[model samples]
Target: MKIRISWWWLPYGILMLASNMWKSALFLLLVLSLHESAHMMAAKAFHYEVPQVVLYPFGFGASILHLGHGSLWRETLILLAGPCVHLVVPFLLIVLVKFDLISITYANYLEQLNQSVLLFNLLPIYPLDGGRILLNFLHLFLPYCCGLWVNYALSVSLVLYLFHETAVLSFQIVLLFLLFQQLLSWLFIKREKEQFYYYRYLSAPKRIRLKHPFQDCFRAFYNVIRFEKEWMQEKAWIRRYFEKEDLKKRKQSHQIML
Candidate 1:
């Protein structure tokens, strides 16, 4: 799909940018834009269509389509591609700075951007790489519902864990924005449950949750860890329906070929 990058993202960013001084805002945009662009390019490389790029003050992201390839590994890799650049860019900048190639004027700023993107994006929230990867991997253990809860659970835990870290610039302020976005996203799911089949499908897909070391350790060692029966039931039924649908789709494809 053809992608559109809105010019308004620049003006809207003023609230974030202007506060950190125009320089901080500018650096923020530069770093986030590069990170998001890497995601777009990776999706395209994998032959998926990307149609929208949304830039925010704290970060920027893209709406990628056709990435639901049904394979846990594929989804995890795709989710990971974005953060790969975040890590790489900072290291390169550090190299340049260390070699006396780049001006020291940006030395502190670059360090902050490096740490910020690494710390922020790595937070185990649903849309974040860590959250996405965790949820997908959780699928192997049982139903999609369980996997989703696992994702949600991990996201929450990760956010809570992040509270102990105090080095990042404006950590609380940025986190508040991220937390607000997450709350609104959850609200969106709740309010539009029926309208969004994908949302429903994600948490309701049928699959067997395998016995991984994580699960074994959690249940065997931590009795406090648990799964919701309602989620498991929903996931079982969804998996069955998906299987039936897939068979029907294949049959249709065969008939067409004949």
Candidate 2:
């Protein structure tokens, strides 16, 4: 897979080294590498093609060639792999330190590094592993459009909360960058409805939760499907009815214009 480092991180790395935090910087890099490697390994194991690995200031990420690749369950496992590695590695470090194979200072550093990686990555913001997991889970129940909207809303909310809690200018700047990145992603998802729908159909047809018979399919096109015991309609049938109703409305509009 193609690998590239963000030039933006170069200055930050230099700053860390110049400030005598070189060991911490090195440990962060090591943890980030392992986390991303875990994702790559999981993708390969699932037979998914990983096209590129990008090294950002915070961490590294591997981009999977998503088209015709893995299922929702497969993707879930892949998404969880990075965090899973973070969960395991600290215990191993502690054991080594306990056995006097490694210094206690080094073990403490590694433990703190791993914990930071775990916490930052587990933030429920889209594009992160945690966010991806939440979105994928939402797609199982909500319509694709609805899931995207909810994801975007959650991202915005978290960004705002972070801004309120932090006085660190650089960290806040990074949060702002993430906010815009998520906004752009939200727009992209909104614009790619057809492609998204097809992928969703293939990956999660059986798990779709929009099983209710609606009074107006057009109005409910982007609505979340809350599972209710009163609704006896199958999701597929409801979706077909919505499609036909949409087509019928378009035809009527065209006839009126003619």
Candidate 3:
């Protein structure tokens, strides 16, 4: 996958250099890279197409093109992979220390960094791994649209609460950026939902069974629903939806011509 550096990284680097914390910044980047690499490896194992990986000042984020179209179980595993790296790395660091490959002081520093990164990433903010895991779990019970709304709402609330509790100016700025990102997502939620449905329409269907017809289709598996004691395939439902949309478009065009 292609690698990109975020524009914010430049200023962040400068700030770190000015503060004489460049070493810490570099170490954090290394840790973040390892974290993202775990995610990439897991995605590859599932044969998902990873388009690009972006490095932000805070951490690294990967763009997996078909991530949302896959089974929820696989998605959850991919999301957990990054955090699992943090959990495993501390033990690895201990091994290195025992072997005298690294000083205990340096190993301690890395361990602390790992913990900090893991904790920050676990915050229930949209687009974060923790937020996504929460969304995936929610999808098991709630309609896809309802789960999305709940995820966004929780993200906004948490960010607002962070703003009140945080005293660090730089961290506050980061929180503000996250808040802005969530607002943009909230504003374009309808468009996102449409794209989500379109993707589901194009992807291969799975034979998952559900008891009731959800407002939106499957988030984890492509479902066949037993609604009112009749079985309904998700593919057929989506096909009918597209047909209706096409008919509406044709009628609009015909009326405009008249």
Candidate 4:
């Protein structure tokens, strides 16, 4: 897959170096790399071809190619893998320190870095892991385009709020750059007719039932089936279908308890 660095990342890297935080910056980049690598591994495991990996100021973003060929659950898993790595690394670091393989101070620094990265990504802003996860969650109930609009709106609002609260010049500049990118996406989505059609198809049901089980498989199937009924006239049928499924599951669960 192709990799490209964001232009904003260049200025941020320079600032870090100028401030004599080059070592910290190097560690941060390595942490981000590990985060993105987790995502790449998940995508690859599912046979999804990642076309590009973009290195941002905070972390890397991977674009999986041929999204239509991939399952939504797989995509969600890929997004989640990044944060999971950050969450899991601290324990591993603790083990290393316990074994005297690494200094406690070094382990603590890495742990803090991982936590920072995790918190930044968990923010509910578009393009971040949290925002993507939120969007995926919304897609479970809302129409695909509606979910995109909501994600964009949340991203815009957060960007503005960050600009207001932020005092750091370098960070403000990065936020502005992110805002610009969001605006461009908004414009494209607004003006392009094909985008609507694409979302519809992208959000369309891939199969009546999942061929194989994966994480959150039932939830994913339910969402797909819900999305399929989104454009249908008879909304009652959709509700009834879900009610029946819920009842069936509850019955099976009760039987297991007995």
Predicted model with the maximum TM-score? 3
> Each prediction's Cα lDDT score?
0.59, 0.70, 0.82, 0.69
lDDT of 4: 0.69
By descending TM-score, how would the candidates be arranged? 3, 2, 4, 1
Tens digits of per-residue lDDT for model 4, 1-258: 798988978788788878998776776777788888898898899877788988887567788764422355777888889888887788888888999988999888888877877897888877778877877787665544566688899899998999999899977986887788788878876333233333334443444543222111222342323333243312233345456667998999999999
lDDT of 2: 0.70
- Residue 224 in model 1: lDDT: 19
The residue ranges of model 1 lying beyond 4 angstroms of the native Cα positions read 1-20, 66-69, 91-102, 160-169, 184-258
Judged by TM-score relative to the true structure, which candidate is superior, 3 or 4?
3
Candidate 2, run of 10 with poorest lDDT = 215-224
User: What lDDT score is found at residue 202 in candidate 1?
Assistant: 58
Pick the winner on lDDT between candidates 2 and 4.
2
Q: Model 4 — which ten-residue stretch has the worst lDDT?
A: 210-219
- Which residue ranges in model 4 land beyond 4 Å of their true spot? 3-13, 54-60, 66-70, 95-103, 190-258
lDDT of 3 by residue, 1-258 (tens): 698989998888888989999877877787787888899899999988888888898678888876655578989999999999888888888898999988999999888878987998898898888888888888877777888899999999999999999999978988898899989988988777767777887784555656466546767666666544577677677676678778998999999999
Residue pairs clashing, model 4: none
Model 2 misplaced regions, further than 4 Å: 57-59, 67-70, 95-102, 191-194, 198-258
Worst 10 residues of 1 by lDDT: 215-224
TM-score per candidate, in order?
Answer: 0.61, 0.71, 0.84, 0.67
